[model samples]
Every structure is written in C-alpha cells, then in structure tokens.
Target: MTRKKGPKIVVIGGGTGLPVILKELHQRNAEITAIVTVADDGGSSGIIRDYVNVVPPGDIRNVMVALSDIAPEFKDIFQYRFRSQDKFLAGHAIGNLIIAALSEMRGGIDPAIRELSEMLQVEGHVYPASAQPLVLHAKFTDGTLLAGEAEITAAHKDIKEVWVGNNPWSENKKPHAVPEALQAIEEADEIILGPGSLFTSILPNLMIEDIGRAVLKAKAEIVYICNIMTQKGETINFTDAEHVRTLNRHLGQNFVDTVLVNTEIVPESYMDFNRYDEVSKQVVHDFKGLREQGARVISDNFLLLRDGGAFHDGQKVVDELMNVCSNPIKKRD
Candidate 1:
C-alpha cells in the first residue's frame, strides 16, 4: 500500500511569527515552501546586506533553523550571534555571514539559499521573494512618503499604501519573484500569509509585481493568520476587518479566501509595555466587517503569551491550516 502525501503549503511572511508557523508545519510533514521577504533594511541583516550586497539573511536564517532536522549544536552554531568587541563581526549572527558568503559564492540569493538548505538539512524549500536586495517604500494617509522598512515602521503614521523596488524612493525597476518562488505558489495546496507585520513583513513579498499577480491567480486557498495584537506604527487601531482590507487594497482585490482570528481576550494589565513596546493592544473584533470582506473567518482561542508577549499558538494555527487544506472552499471564477 502507498502512503498518503501531506498537503503542499506555501507560507509567505518574515519576522518572528513566520518561523513559529513553519516549525509546526514541518512537524506535520507538509510539503513546505517559505517565500521570504528581501525588503528588510535594518539591524544585522541590513549591515550584512550593505557590506556583501546580498539579500537580508535574518529572516531566512530563522526560517532555515525552524525547518531544519539537524542536530541541536549545528542549529545553535547557525543562530550564534557574535559578541566580540571588533566592530565588523560584532552583533552579527554567524548564519547571516554564512548566507552572505554563499550568496556571493553562488552568484545569487536563490542559488545560495538552495545550497544552504541542502547543507542544513532543511525540510522544505526556502526561496527569497526576489533575487536582489530590496527596499520598502510607503505612502502615508496624510500624503507623506517614507522609504525603508525600518523608517516606515518607525514613522508611526497611518500608511495609505506600500510597495517594493530596487531603489528606496523610486518605483522604477519593479521587483519580481524568483522562478522557484512563483512555481511553489502555483503548485501549493494552501498559501498562508501573515502572523507577521502587515505592511513590513507580509506585504513586502506581495508588493513585488509578478509575485502579487501569481498569488491572485493561484488555484490554492489563500489563508491569512491575523495578528494577535495591534502593532504600534503599522496597525495601531486597525480592526480585524481592516487588516484584510489593507491586504486587498495593496493587492487590488479581495483575494484572501479565509482568515484565522484569535477570539481569546488578553487582560488589560497583562501587557508589559517596556518589554513589548512594538505591540499596542489586543485587536478588536468586527465579525461583521470581516464578513463584509467576503472572507470565511475562523475565530478561535489561538493566543499564547510567553514572557508577557502575545503570539499565535503554532499548533492551533497549523491545525486550522490543515482543516482549510482538507476542505478547501470552492475557488472563485
């Protein structure tokens, strides 16, 4: 007798939330493909990108560790951050440097990631959304514009729209997804977005011209795992429905077929502002608004607090995603 195959899941996003989802999905034996954002221009990733002229490796490193079935010591070495007094190596993760080196060795980010994935015993394919380094640009509701993912998030202004490009201030030379990234989406059984920053982590991938088009045209069910808490500069007062609306506004259509929302409440005093400064408050519920967006909302107690920070329970999210894959909603013509 032949064994049944697992669902093909393509997850799009970056930052901390993405790894959580990927690790859970890896354990479930799904055919996983992670399309990571290359628009990051801050922290260790930015430093490495500037020095080596490569895609930011911070998100990709985390995703690699998440899906890796390698030994614990090896994983630790990949994630190890240097604390040396030397300025060049200080504050950079070894894995970021390794990725930068490999990117140069292989002549491009896509090939570098492929080589790294094999060496790290990665359980799934990891593709950079674009081959080159990208910068994120945003137009605020007040008609103000900002460049760079870090700058845009730090502005604390209401964002009207966001896009990706080779240059920060100009939209010329629009970014395009690598062939592998596009093909993964086309072949996936389910595509999951978010559990990360709305404008920065998640939207940056979709902001790419051809990648956005591919997602809109893909036959699989596109599901969004809504953020558990409102982010300060990004989605300060955004309701659950507004989150979906923002995505649709960027993509030019209501393409998200399903949304997984956290129904559990966080006590007012439970939040530690100093520790979790980026988080604003618990996202308010608006089932009516979500339904208005034509999304089949699956609300549940998906919240998990660790060290006073709120996050999605990886298991719960994977369970919900599995259900969505098993009983997909009929596709729209």
Candidate 2:
C-alpha cells in the first residue's frame, strides 16, 4: 500500500490506554488501523469469552467507540454494562454481547469487526490480533509458568518471557495473526506500541509469530509510547530504557526506532492511592541505557494529571507521533 490522503498508522496494544491514543488519532484523519490484543482472560471480557467461545470484546468494543463517529446515545447504549441485579446479563456490556454474537454468526472475529466498523461509521480499521482467541502464557523469572493474562499479573512475579498458544476449542492449536493485521503492519508508515501494559496488553500482540516477524521486517518507524507511571505488578522500579530492553529481548532484535518518553514529574503528594491502587511510581529515565539499546528517545512534558492519577497526554504524544511520521526512521540493528 502507498500513501493516500494521510499517513497509514498502525497502533497495537490492549487495555484502557489504547483508546486514549486512538481517540486523538481519529481527530487527525490519519489512516489508522488498530491491531488489538485478544488475550484477555479477566473481568467482563473473560466471562464473555468463556461462555460465547469468542474473543473477548471489552478492548475491541472500546476501540470501536474511540474511532466511531456515531451519536453519543448509541455509544452509551453499546458501552452500558448490566447491573448486578440483571442476573444472566450482569457485568456484560451490550457491545460485548453484540460482538460475541456477530463473531459466532460471521464465523470469525475478523469479519465480525469489519462488519461492525461499517455500521458504526468507524474512521479506521480495527483487527483482532488473531482470528481465534489467543491464550497468553507467561514464564516468570522464578521458573514458574502461568497460562492466563489475569493469572500472570496476579502472581506479581517477575515475568521472564511470554508467548501465545491456542485455546482447546481452536483446531489449529498454534496461534495465527489475522492476515489484515499482518498487512497493516507491512504497509504502515508508522507503527505505535503501547500506552498500555508491558507484558500483557502490548507484548501479547507481538508474541504472535507472524505479527512479531512482520513488525521486525517492516519499513516503518516503530514507536513505543512508554507508559507514564509504573504498574505495581509489572514495572515497579523500571527505567525507561529497561522497558526498551525488555521489548528488544522479547523480539530478539532492536526493532524500536523511536521511543516517546514523558519527562514531567508526578508529585507524590498529588497521587490518590484510593483511585490508583495499582500504580507504583513514575518510570525513571536512563538515556544512556536507551541509547545503548539503539532507540532515539524523544522526551517531553507529556503528562496529564487527571482524577488524581497520572497518564500520558494523548495530544502531546500524538503530536510527536505525527512528527516521527513526517520524518520516518527505520533504526533496527
């Protein structure tokens, strides 16, 4: 694919952080394609996935809302979760149920999402990392193994490496990337990773054999929007470069061309523990370490203090993303 009206940007990851970036990107009219994680096995997504036997719709549903140009009432209806009093439907979002049904009816998640995208008037394409649901397996430094995304985080052990495999229901038994996702990676002018979990949300998408291989071989400026605050169970005391190192070690190459880092200080006094119980501290910086790993670092005051917690300012990061796209780099070693 060649350049059209705008830059073709492929954003990868799962969790709440993904939609933040996508929402801002939609405003830019950049040709966007989101390759979302399907390895969730927690909360409403886990329950829906188990019973529906389809990929969890929580993350994908949010991504839809981010890029969709529908009315607010429609968005509300789709995102509405059932009350605890609503027995069978309790905790399930209407969109999740709809996605599950569509996936079942359409024979796969790939086609289901494309159908929904058209209906929602989505500004961009959204692809599940795989057709069938992927089971994320984590190997801890303690030599312990966990099979589910929820379990890996709950264990709070140092993650050594992670990989993906098929659920028992999958006939292939080996995970496969949806072809559209691979093609997006191949054709993208810029590929963005994260603003989400290091080991779970982002890595799970990359762990798929074909997606990882495609990203490694692609001629795009691969940027990692490093998380602003350290997650308690994941990156307790990690430097920005440690995050890059972890990513490089996993892919077995220095594929990251640029890393966007937030330099603003989050005052310890400003953080509300009740609101952000999972947050540890701000991720410290190590410019030397990042340079050693071969990524050009772009640091800025990209912080947004909201609801008594810290997060990346989506516009600030996206501005930098567009700049990187303007002058693309392919700094792989």
Candidate 3:
C-alpha cells in the first residue's frame, strides 16, 4: 500500500508571523509553498535592493528558514544581524546578504530562492509575490498617495488601499507573479493569509494582478489567521471582522472562507507598550461582521503572550489550519 500524502497548502503573507506558522506546518509535513511580499524597502533588504536592484530578500529568507530542515544553530547564524559597531554590515542579517548575493549570481530572485531552498534543505517552496522587486503604492483615506512600503508605513494614516508596480531601479518593469506561485494556488488544497501587518505584509502580495486574480477564483478553501492586535499606523481600531472586511474590500469580493479568531483577552495592564510599540490594542471581535462578509469564524483562546507582548499561538493556529483542510466549512450560496 502507498503512503498517504499531506494536504497542499499555499500561504500568502510576510513579516515575522508568517514564519512562525510555516515552521509549525513544516513539522506536520504538509506540502507548503510560501508566497512572500517583495515590496519591502526598509532595513537590510532596502539597502540591498537599492544597490543591487533585486527583490528584497528579508521576507523570503525568513520563510525559507521556517521551512528548512537545517540544524538549529545554523538557523540562528543565518538570522543573526550585525551590531551597529560593524559599520560595513551594521543591522544586516547574514541571511539577507547571502540571499542578495544569490539573487545577483542567479540573475533573478525566483531562481536565487530555488537554489538557496535546496541548499538550506527547505522542505517547502518559497516564491516572491512578484518576479521583480515591487514598488508599493498606497492611497490614503485622506486623499493622499505615497510610494514605497517604508514611506507608506511611516505615514501613519488610514490607508484607503494599496497596489504594487515596477521598482524605479527596474527601468519601469511591470509586476507579475512567478509561474510557480500561480500553479501552487491553482492546485492547493487550502490557501492561508496573514497573521502579519494587514496593509504592508499581506496586501502587497495580493495586489499583484495575476496572483490577485488567481486567488479571487481559487477553488480551495481560503482561511485567514487574523492578527491578535490592531496595529497603530495601519489598523488602529480594526476589529476581527474589519480585518476580514478590509481584505475583501481590497480583493473586490468576499474571498476569505474561514477566519481563526482569538478569544483570549490580553490583560489591561499586561501590555508592554515599550516592546510592542506599533501595536494599538487587542483586535476586537465582531462575529456578525465576519458573517456579513461570508466568513465562518472559528473563535478560540488562541492568544500567546510572552516578552510583554501578544501573538497568535502558532501551534493552535496550525492545528486549526490542518483541521480546516480535512473538514472544510460549507459555504453559503
């Protein structure tokens, strides 16, 4: 008798939260593909993108590490960032530099990731949302427009919407998804989005035309791991339903099939503002609002608090995702 294979899952997002979920999914031996945002234009990724004119490597590198079978010590060394004293490589993670070099040597980010994924013993696929570096543009609710992910983030206003286009350094190249990403979405058993920054990390990937279109029409059950907290600059007062609504609004339809929401309350005085600076407060729940957007909510005590901050329990979230794959919710007609 042949052994059974696990479900095919395609996760779309960026930032620290994405890796946590990926790491847990890899442990379950799920067939995973991470479509990371390349609209980043800050930190080490920004410096490399500016100089090398390649897609930012930060998110992709993190995703690769999450899905890798490499030794623990090696993972640490890869994620280690230089101190300010190291003037030449200050604040840059070793993995970022390595990825940037590979991108140049391989002539494009997609090929570079493929080569690195093999070397790192990655158990899952990692693809940038766009083939080339994307310049993130936003239209604010105040009728203002800004370019660059960093600039848009720093604006700290209500973001009306966001879209991606060619990086200035790319001679006005257009943004398009790699073929692998499209294929992964087309064949996936389930699709997952976020536990990351609503505007910056998650939306940039979907704004790519081909990717967005594919997601809109995908046959798989799409689940969202909603953020535990509302972000200051992006989602200051956003509720769980609002988060899902915002996603639907951006996609021009209610594409999300299920949402994992945390019911565990963060203590009033327990929040350490110093550590989680950009966080405003816990994400308020509105099950009715979620239902209004055609999403079935799986509410649970899924919050994990540590180091004076709040986050989704990756184990719990992955458990829910696995359950969702096997027992998909019946969508209302």
Candidate 4:
C-alpha cells in the first residue's frame, strides 16, 4: 500500500494564528508556505527593528518554531525571553537578536531567514510580504490616523480604513517574494487565512499589494478560519459575517470562498478565564450574511479552549482544511 501525498497549502497571517495552522498542516505532511506579516512593532521584535533596523522577526520566529523538527529544548531556546533591569537585554528574545545579527551579516532578510530556517530544521518555508520594514497605517472612523502596528493595536479606536506605508520602504524593490510562497500558491489545492487577530495578524499580510495579487490570481480554494472571539481593541464587536466582510473589503469579494467557524458550545467556566463576559460575548454564525457575500460557512467543534471560551480545535481545523482541499467546491460568479 502506498500513501498519497498531501496537498500544498499557503497560509497567510501573522502572530500565533499562522503558526498554529502551520504546525497542524505540517503534521498532515502537507506542503506548506507561511506568508508572515513583518509590520510588528512590539516586544522583542520592536527592540530589534528599532535599534538594529531589520524586519521584525517575531512572527517569523513563531512560524519557524511552529514548523521546526527540533527537540523541545531547541524550541525553548528559540522562544526564551530575557528580562533585566538593564535596558539592553530587557524584553528581548535571544532568537530575535540572533535574527537581527544574521540580517546585519547577510545584508538582507531573505538570506538571514534562510540561515535560521536551516538551523531550526523547519518543516516549511516562511517569508515576509516584503523585504523592507513596513508600517501599518489605519484611518479611524473619525478620520484620525494611526500608524505602526503597536499604535494601531493600542489606539482603541474604530478603524475606517487601513493600508501599508507608501514611503520608500514600500517602493519598487520586490522583496523577492519567496519562490516557495509563489510556488505553493500556484500549486496549492487550498489556502487558509486565519483563526488569528483579524486586523493585526491576518489583514496586514494581505495589505501587501504583491501578496494580495497572488491570492487574487491563485487558482486554489481559499478558506478563512474565523476567530473564536473578538479581539479587545482591534475587533470590538465584529461577528463571523463581519470578519468575512472586512476580509472581502481588503482582499476583494471573491478572495475567500469558505469560512470555518466554531459551533461547539464552550463551558461557562472556560469563559471566565477568557474574560468573555467582559468583552463582546459571542460571534454568532451569520449564515445568511456569509452566503450573501458568496462564502460558505462550515461550522463544527472548532473551539479548542472551550470551558466557556471559544478557540479553534487545531485537529478539527486541520481535518476540515484537508477535507476542503480534497473536495473543493466551485465558487459562484
């Protein structure tokens, strides 16, 4: 008996969400490409970018750790954060500093990431949307402008619009879109968007013109893993349909073909830990609204951290993704 090869998949997102999905896909023996957002401006990544002048490496680091074949000890080393009263070593990870050093020595981010990937023995390729450092700019509903990932995340303002900086950093240099990324999209049977923070994690990558164009032109099934709960400041009152609507607003109406939502009820105790009662309660499945936007909703036991709080069931999410890839449904025009 022979085993069939798994489908190729390109996952576009940043932060914890992309890594979670990537880890699951790797377990399934799927060919994976993670297109990570490089606009991060917080914590260890921020320190490296501000002082060393490099692409924020936090998201990339997360992806590497998620897809790595190394033992837990190595993984722990990659994720270790240093704390000190001294400003120099405070709040920075050894990995972030290493990536910064590599970026400096290699004279570019692509080669630096490649070097790290080799050391980590990662299972899949990870690429930033662009090589240069980019900023995320958001216009509030009141016309106030918020710039940078940190500011936008902390603004506590309703966003009216969002786009990447149009400065020289975002200029014509192609950032050498990873060959693996483009190839994955071109050959992919399916693409998964997220179960991550919508504005900061997911959309930031899509905001890159080249990446968005690739997603638009790719001849593959696109699936969106909706967030289990609304993010505090970023997505205050967004529902499942609203998440899809916002994605369409950015990626285009036809960019996403399916949405996997969590339908399993979570225990009330879990909700307390998640502080669900304090924030927007639940993101109800708006089947009608989703269908209206030409996206099908696949509801299941996607809540993993369920006590009362919702989360993506990693295994179930991967299962649904595999099923969709194996039997793709044609999109309506």
Tens digit of lDDT per residue, candidate 3, span 1-333?
012358889999999999989989988857898999999999999999899888898999899998888899999999999999999999999999999898889888877887888888988788898878888999999999999988888888999899989986666456889899999998888999988998999999999989999998788899999999899779989999989988999999999999999999899698899888888888989999999888989999888888888988889999989999989874322
Q: Write the per-residue lDDT of candidate 4 for residues 12-87, one digit (tens) a residue.
A: 8887667777888878968777888777888888777877778898988888888899899989988888777757
Worst 10 residues of 3 by lDDT: 1-10
Note the Cα lDDT for every prediction shown.
Answer: 0.90, 0.90, 0.89, 0.78
What TM value does model 3 have? 0.96
Model 1 earns a TM-score of 0.95
| Weakest lDDT window of 10 consecutive positions for candidate 2 | 1-10
Model 1: residues >4 Å from true position, as ranges? Answer: 1-5, 84-86, 168-172
Q: Which pairs clash inside model 3?
A: none
Cα distance off (Å), candidate 1, residue 325 = 0.5
Sorted on lDDT, best first, the list reads: 2, 1, 3, 4
**Can you write out model 2's per-residue Cα lDDT over 1-333, one digit (the tens) per residue?**
212449899999999999999999988959999999999999889998898889989999999999999999999999999999999888989999999999989987878887998888888889999888889998888898889999888887788889999988889967999998999999989999998999989999999999999999998899999988888667778899989999999999988989999999999999998888878889999999999988999999999998898988889889989999988766322
How far residue 138's Cα lies from its native spot in candidate 2, in Å, is 0.9
The sequence of per-residue lDDT tens digits that candidate 1 reaches over residues 1-333 is: 012348788999999999999999988958889999998999999988887888899999999999998899999999999887868788999999999999899887877887888888888888889888898999999999999999999999999899888954334466778998999898888999979999999999998988999999999999999998999889999999999999998999999999999999987688788998989988988889888988999999998878878889999989989999989894533
Model 1 lDDT, residue 260, Cα: 95
Report how far residue 249 has shifted in candidate 3, in Å: 1.1
Error of 3 at 134 (Å): 0.6
